[model samples]
Target: MSDLQFDSSSAGIGEICKAIICLEIAANMKHVLFDRQTAIRLSGMSEKAYIRSFNVMQNGIGVKNTLDIKELAIQFGCVRLIPLVRKGLSLYRERFIASLPPSRRASADFTRPVFTATGFYLCAKKHKLKVNKNKLIELSGTSEDEFSSVSTSMKDLCHDVFGVSTEKKDPKSVKVNRDLLDVLPEKRQAEDGGYSSDEGKDV
Candidate 1:
């Protein structure tokens, strides 16, 4: 890390952004992209403002050695926002990758979609459960503010969650991939791309 003590308080948002970039390098988390979409959802900031704040933090205190950036840790609450420790995440991602069989490792970067809306609806009904549209939205964590596209996206998530996904449908339904599922803070499984919470132990 540079020994430079930049007085970023006087700088504009652009400079603050520079601080973030500098911090990412210092923290050695270059491969892991900041999850802006998740942040936007949690922060309740407009997309434009979210991006701007991220930039400012990066350029300001990130480059200022005198400031106690660690305090932000308590403020943000979620550890995910704290600058990543590259060594730790690297060890984590690598260990999980190694645990996967060759085939799964090859496809870790891509996610295939699971099912049709009708299939999901039928499956839910078969379980003697009614598919409340609002309930679906709650489970999917999507907004009803936007119409058609949002609806379709939630349906897709629901289809996957219901195990109605036709693509790469693993009917045998093994325990979810430990690598993918285990990495979450709570060891969670994917429910074969569609069902919700198969086992509390798994996630």
Candidate 2:
């Protein structure tokens, strides 16, 4: 892999999960895929190196390189993906918390707000489709890098996030948990009487 790339061939389970989730988010937005340019950017590699590592990642995850975008969305946006993604993220966060030397972890909570997997899942459910990361970041009032970090650590959770089947199911039967709604920040009015969060921002 090129120095810019993450060496997907040797990527740990967490990295794979992160890629899958990012790709899925891109698809669900209905306007983009992890297209060549974006993939190259994300991988931080030249075209040649990216293709090689892309093949490795696809082969490692048992997915085809030419996967249909619609099918990809349907597959990754489903309920099946939610639990695994959520679990993977939870595991990653646990590790993150554990790795912190007690003093920092305490302050980390408020200082470092994350766009979590559970939050992403809930956002997808809210629209009944995959969500756009831009909109999500805007809504959360968080930095893009912070959101990207959340998206990346998605794969760093557990091995179980991989090897999941993408078989389609009747989504109509699935019941959503209302408690998960807290992932979103509520709109608040500022002294100027404008929206305090992303509620009024263009998506």
Candidate 3:
């Protein structure tokens, strides 16, 4: 054998080799995707070594940055609702930014799990999909309290921006505001007559 020394532990030679092999296989076989076991076998790396390397890479890259809402939805067994979830996430982000003050808007950031849970909940509700709130919370890895708070904000956003009411209304108890009604005629008359209180005032 040729004289060669490799410090696999310190240099992460195994991980680098595994990654290169896996990438080459993926590039060559466009349609074929390898599972963890297959990838480990093909890479000639031990399972533990592969797992440790994956963890190191994942941690270095940052889990939050890599977190995917679509993957989370699949984990929650809502793969069929990905489109709705995406729409909800987009609208939620818009509404969230609009709600923040100019100064705070720049610093605005949401807890990822809570944010994802809220978006999923909102879209599921809007579409009348029967999703378990508890399951969503569990899958998102967020507490019930946190999810509830964010969900409340999302509901308000749906009502205010989309005109989709989240609360039940009692039509029987509805009463017209007579005072506001009495002011409508005068307001209409002023508009129609091109009349304004400031019209006669000199600038």
TM-score of 2: 0.30
Candidate 2 or 3, higher TM-score? Answer: 3
Off by over 4 Å in 1: 1-84, 110-203
lDDT string for model 3 (11-107, tens) is: 3546555464335334323422234455557667664444344333332333332235676566556677788777766776666666555875665
Tens-digit lDDT track of model 1 for 1-203: 32254443343234444444454434323222233345455656554444334333433344321112233223324233234322222333354456567876765531111111222333444344454544332222222232223223333333333333465433233232442232121112133543133221111
Measured by lDDT, the strongest candidate is 3
lDDT of each: 0.34, 0.39, 0.48
Candidates 2 and 3 compared by lDDT, better number:
3
TM-score of 1: 0.22
RMSD of 2: 18.6
- Evaluated with TM-score, which candidate comes out highest? 3
Question: Which of the predicted structures, 1 or 2, would earn the higher TM-score when compared with the native?
Answer: 2
Of 1 and 2, the candidate ahead on lDDT is: 2
lDDT of 2 by residue, 33-117 (tens): 3344454566555444443333334334443222222332354555545554455446545555655557656543311223342
